[model samples]
Target: MRVLVCDDEPLARDRMRRMLERIPATLCVGEAENGQELLERVPSVYPDIILLDIRMPGMDGLQAASRLSESDSPPAIIFCTAYDEHAIAAFKVNAVDYLLKPVRQEDLEKALSKAGRVNKAQMLAVRRETGVAQPEQANAKEREYISVRSRKGIDLIAVADVRYFLADQKYVTVRHSQGETLLDETLKELETEFGDRFLRVHRNALVALSYIEALEHKGNQFYLRIQGVEERLAVSRRHASSVKKLLQSL
Candidate 1:
């Protein structure tokens, strides 16, 4: 499997590279210092798997994984981070697996094994939980669309055309190429259902990584611009590093 290893620390990157050499199906296709480098190399390398770190200098791994999910096809994402607090969020993002820092060879092997079973849709669900059932279901006919409950009735939206989802108190606004629709679900509920395709940019907002145009930083604050949208979304201070890293990767 072609693999991309991303981390800010040189020693950490080297250690991951060395450990990967022991795996038979794995190949170190590239190494990135931050999320930005990963994004730039993704189109050309087309790695099968990515070993991503949660923290970095510019862009962090979580943001990078979010951006990668926007591509026509995305690789399996395995978060390799030091913090346990991110585990819940990582699973919400549909990461194939989460590996704590100082990744063990056995754990890496297990992750790779999991990656091998995953397909593109599964990878997409892992990124945003857009309703894909499993890694193998990516190729199944039943997995291509999502049903949204609205005042009109049950509407099915093709998963690919969805741009983003906005949370407004108890309601969720589903934004797509055609327009927007309101659903009676919380952001947290949507996170459970479509976690593969949506990422929480803020506490209330879950956005489609593909629709993100750019990220701007002013002092310690950060905001995201979405394609065809005039509004700039604010990212929390806690998620700032991850957002920047994701933009760099894009």
Candidate 2:
């Protein structure tokens, strides 16, 4: 597992780095002087876990942790603080564990052992505590691909390639860059998971916002013109107003 050490004090970071070396299974991938540095390095380092210090110069560990938690994929946090008074607050921020500073080797080892490598499921559970539903939280990241079975084998369809999903009786037709394919998932589930990129136009259809060309109102009916695909999808009267609002925002 890749671990990131974050502390303003050079000596504190050195001690933690040395202790981490003793555990050959884990690698100290990066180190940051303060919370600001930690945020800057996080995207590049992509550490599995971060050992964060509570009090920092530009930004505090708690503030940094909050911002990190909002990320599509946030690393697990283990806060190291000198003040015991911050223990309750640490847990409130969904930290894996809090170690009192001058952190002890035993405590550090214990915390590391608790969460060897946090997965999306673990992160979803933590996000649930903050009132986001576990199901939606699990897919906070715009899913890069959709797995669909083809005549040859399974195809990994890029989400960006998909123009729209039109539901049939039991299956959904995925109209994409190459053509169309069948998907087993429901339109409602796809609407919730990819809400940022997709907009539900009808009861059975969800179209990609990026591919939307224009909205037309003809003979008291509304239709959506999509990019690449010449076929226009009907927009239900119930959803036409909401779709217009979304399109206007873009």
Candidate 3:
């Protein structure tokens, strides 16, 4: 399997590399010093798995993992961290395995063994929870398409074709280029699955990054307007800070 080792510390990265060599005769496609580099390399190499560190410069592993999980064919993720606090959260994000550092050969083997058993769709599901690795590149090839179940059976929706997703009780309402469809998934789950393409506007809603036209505030309430959609989405006051940060970056 092609693998990418991501860590900020040079020694940590080197140690992981050495451990990887002993586990199996897998190709070390490349190594990333931080999350940003991981995002840049993932698309080009399409590694089968990524050995991610929880702490790093620029973007932390958790944040990076959140982004990488949105790719069409995202690599299996195994958290290699020095801390144990993130173990529960890691599982919540659908991480295959969580290995605390110094990483042991036994632990790495177990993680890989489990990874081998997972199917492609399961891996894709994990990626969806973590979010997309990077912003949609204008020239980059579109990876996977989402199939939304409709009255007409399954309606295939391109990732780029979606505008936003609204949480409705147990199901999520997907707003696409043509129209909306309901799926049996929560907004939080969808946030984990399609994080790369969508951003959380409120506790119960996520909006596609591409479809967001602007953010407007009236009185104490904030709202997000989509390009084609006429209705404005309410942005919760609690998440306003994060929303502003995202908008400023864009």
Best by lDDT: 2
Cα lDDT for residue 230, model 3? Answer: 91
lDDT of each: 0.72, 0.77, 0.71
lDDT of 2 by residue, 111-154 (tens): 88775535334444443343322234326466789999888999
What's the CA RMSD for each of the models? 14.3, 12.4, 14.6
Instruction: lDDT for model 1, please.
Output: 0.72
The model with the greater lDDT, 2 or 3, is 2
Q: How many residue pairs clash in each candidate?
A: 22, 0, 12
> Model 2 — TM-score against the truth?
0.49
Model 1, 88-178: lDDT tens digits are: 8777666899999878999999998888668434454443433222222222233456678766878888755566778887777877778
The model with the greater TM-score, 1 or 3, is 1
In model 1, what is the error at residue 197, expressed in angstroms?
26
Candidate 1, superposed: residue stretches over 4 Å from native: 120-250
